[model samples]
Target: MKKIAAFLLSIGPGLFCIGYTVGTGSVTSMAKAGSQYGSQLLWVLALSCIFSWALMEAYGRYAVVTGRTAVNSFKTELKFGKVLAVVLIVGIVIGQWNSLSGIVGLSANALYEIARLFLPGLPAESYWAVLSIAVVILAILYFLLIVGKYSFFEKILILFVTIMGVSFLISMFIVLPPPGEIAMGFIPSIPEGEGGSLLVAAFVGTTMAAPTFVVRPLLMQGKGWAREHTSLQSRDALSSALLMFVISASIMVTAMGALYYKGLTINKVIDMVYTLEPVAGKFAVALFMTGALSAGLSSVFPILMVAPLLISDYKNGELDLKSKLFKRLTAVACVVGLSVPILGANPIAAQIATQVANVFVLPLVIGGIIYMVNRKAVMGEHRAGWLLNTGLVLAFIFSCVISVIGFTALKDFF
Candidate 1:
């Protein structure tokens, strides 16, 4: 019992980050994955899991060892380095612009589904954006300015969402993928078709380049995680990051295997709630919706956190645990996060832009990560190992190659 308790405690950071990983994008992307490629890209998920774990640990360790966030570290670099940081902030904003819209839009879709049960015409397209933005601001106020401490609040939300997510994961098992098909997911393969390629870019963009990954290590630093750093803690951080990947993959698989595999793709996430009922029967979708909601709310806390972090970094100094700038930044972040959907915004546009922002910003974050990880001075004794380096190189190369492919594929769209 004690061992189990210790294990669970150790898993908290990873689990918390993992909860956020199962957001609307993961759900939708997985649904897309299952529908188009039909488990062919299952291998991509596997490779991503490995890559996410390695990168998170390496990046987080850089922050921990050097006492610098990725943003600040970039700022500290030489003149061209600052240019890199500028590019990073700008690009991430673009990539996340689409993704941020997507998250709110997906939440609105889920809410629309939930509301259809009680009041058929309650939600409009504009309302979702407003509500999402409102919720983000309110959540920020609650944590940042009002309560002043978010540890307990964050923990509870993560726990609740993780439980909600796990319910969906279990249902996927009950849906019973063929052992052979399931095993085949472990093998790497891309799906055939142009749409498949777009979906793949979106899927990869949804989780990997998303702002959430950039913030996880920051969260770790804020939590005083490095003060007591250990190999065990290092492993724990890796576990947390991979756990993020695992839960994300689980949601995708659940949507893909149970929903998408059945030709049940919808334009938005709420469609799953509608379609899941007819195909997977009853409880499975309820579990899925609960998971989706959990995913949405888990993000609320972090979206709130980003504003202040950016502000403090912008102020060009150490983060004072207690300061007005902290409060202001926190408040501003929440507002910015929530401001998008004011007075009712377009749900679909919001949804698509949410990840588009991430795509735009990804190059900088990726560049920062690669540069830092390779700088042995920053990482110290716990610097990138051969295995992590290999994975980083591979992921970096893959991302670059895919950028070319993605550009080629979507050239006409642009």
Candidate 2:
């Protein structure tokens, strides 16, 4: 029991990040990629996960060494820091609400479908039913954040992640993707198809989101980690990010093995559930939905955390998680998260907007991190090494290129 307790206590910022990164957007993007192109797009997932780890490690390290959050560092150290901080706070608040709505909306779909198993007459086509389910979930989440202990919150997220990881792994094993084809995905090649390029770009953009870094410093500080914990923090970041890759790839591989060659395409996020039922059995379908719902619920907490944490950073105010103002702010954010779902946001449209649209803000965020990490006055002896700088530069350039690609895809969509 002691050992088990110790293990759970060790999970921190990295686990929270894993929770946020693998939400419905990832499930939709990865599963679609796998369904349409087999394991051919695994290379993109690999690269994006690697980039996420590198950038997250850098951000956490900065916070530990400098004892400053990203928004705090920006507000104090540079000329346009205040503007940058404001931009991040506003952008993430808006972006995260969109993401939250999508997540709850997606989860409600799975939950409603599950309900249909026991309640024979439940309406499968009711959007308002989905909205009501989402509202109830949102209210519960909001209440928990307002009243729950911070450690309790972290433990809940880790539990959800565990549920997601186990279910997805088991589902993947049931589907059993071809080993040779999976290996070929590592060699990196463009998938040729109608939506291949757009999917690839979306995969990269969503996986390496800017908010991941923006939220990192706050989580690290909240955990009371210091410079001495750098190695531990790096390990946490790498492990969580790699775990993200495994779960994401598993979704893809399952799609490839079960749906791809059968000539079925995933048109909606929940459609993967139906695809699995026909091939992997009802049990596999239930397990996959369990993981999908876990993924979606896990993200709600972090998505809510993003804006409040940033607002605190910008204001340099109290860090109490249970304060009245904190609760009010979180309440307002929850309302924002529910805005689209309550209005009957289409699942596909929500996925596109949340997963791919907000990525347009990545370049600036990446650039800000690059500038901050290299400044001697802020980092002092803990400045980023040349290797880290190289990675940042490459990440920045890659993000810019992908953002352009994503925008072009959007333009073509309209």
Candidate 3:
């Protein structure tokens, strides 16, 4: 027990990263992909996790060596650094806030689904009920943000991540897919259909997330890590990526087993519950909803923090939770997050669109980090080696390809 506790403590930032990465967007993307394509897109998830780890290492190492967060590094290290930093802050905040709406919406809807499971008399489509739930959840989380410290939030995220992982893994085992089909999913073949391009792009966007890498250095800084912690950072990055793969794969495979084989699809967050109930039983549905709720709630904290955190990063690379600006910005995010539920928008669609849009910023993020890590003035003796550079270059190329796909996919939505 002591060893396990020590291990969890050591990987605090990585768990936080997982909490951010494996949110409702990821759950929806993986679930949608599995229900539609049945493990065919697993290659994308695998590649994204690999590149996520690589980019995280670059971002974390730069912070550790130079004692600078990503936005601060961008502002200080690059030519036209100030302009780039401002652009990144604006773009990521816009994207993350948009995501928060979908996240809170899905969370509220999932809770409603669970509630209805017990009380079948609840209205089938109660917008106010969902909005009320969203209000309460956001209020609670925002209160925690105001009163809690970074370590407190970190511990909370650890618990959420654990619930998400355990629930999904157990549910996956309950509806385990064939080993052969799971193995074949790694062979790398794109699904051919209308939404294939969008799902492909979203899979990459949600996993190899720009905010995850950008926020990583900030989290590491929050942890008070330094140059001597580079090795620890690498291990954390690897573990984070691996766990991302495991939880993501589990969600996908569970959907593949329960829905794909049974010829059903997930059109919304609640569809997952309704479809899984008859096929996998009430217990499975409960567990799935529990996992989804955990994913949604875990992500809300980081999503709310991104705008203020990046603004802080650009300003001085320090996180000041006590600042009025932080409080105001977070409050603004909480209100914005209620938009989807109040507007009665489709949470699943909102999440997918937000994630697809995230692809547009990836090239800049990957390019910026690569440029920063390679600079001798910033990194000095701790510059990124050729191997890391190669991974980043590949990530950049992948980002460009997915951006094009995302653009093409977005056209269909209009």
By lDDT, the best candidate is: 3
Give the alpha-carbon lDDT of every model: 0.59, 0.80, 0.90
Model 2 lDDT-worst window of ten = 317-326
Tens digit of lDDT per residue, candidate 1, span 82-201? 676566655654444344445654565565566554464755344644475457535644464445444654556556555655766776775655668767776766677556666656
What is candidate 3's lDDT per residue for 328-378, written digit by digit as tens?
999999999999998999999999989888888889999998888998976
Q: Model 3 residue 407 lDDT? A: 92
Per-residue lDDT of 140 in model 3: 93
TM-scores, all candidates, are 0.82, 0.94, 0.98
- What is the lDDT for 251 in model 1? 64
User: What shift in Å separates residue 197 of candidate 3 from its native position after superposition?
Assistant: 0.4
Model 3 has an lDDT value of 0.90
* Residue 301, model 2, lDDT: 82
Clashing pairs in 2: none
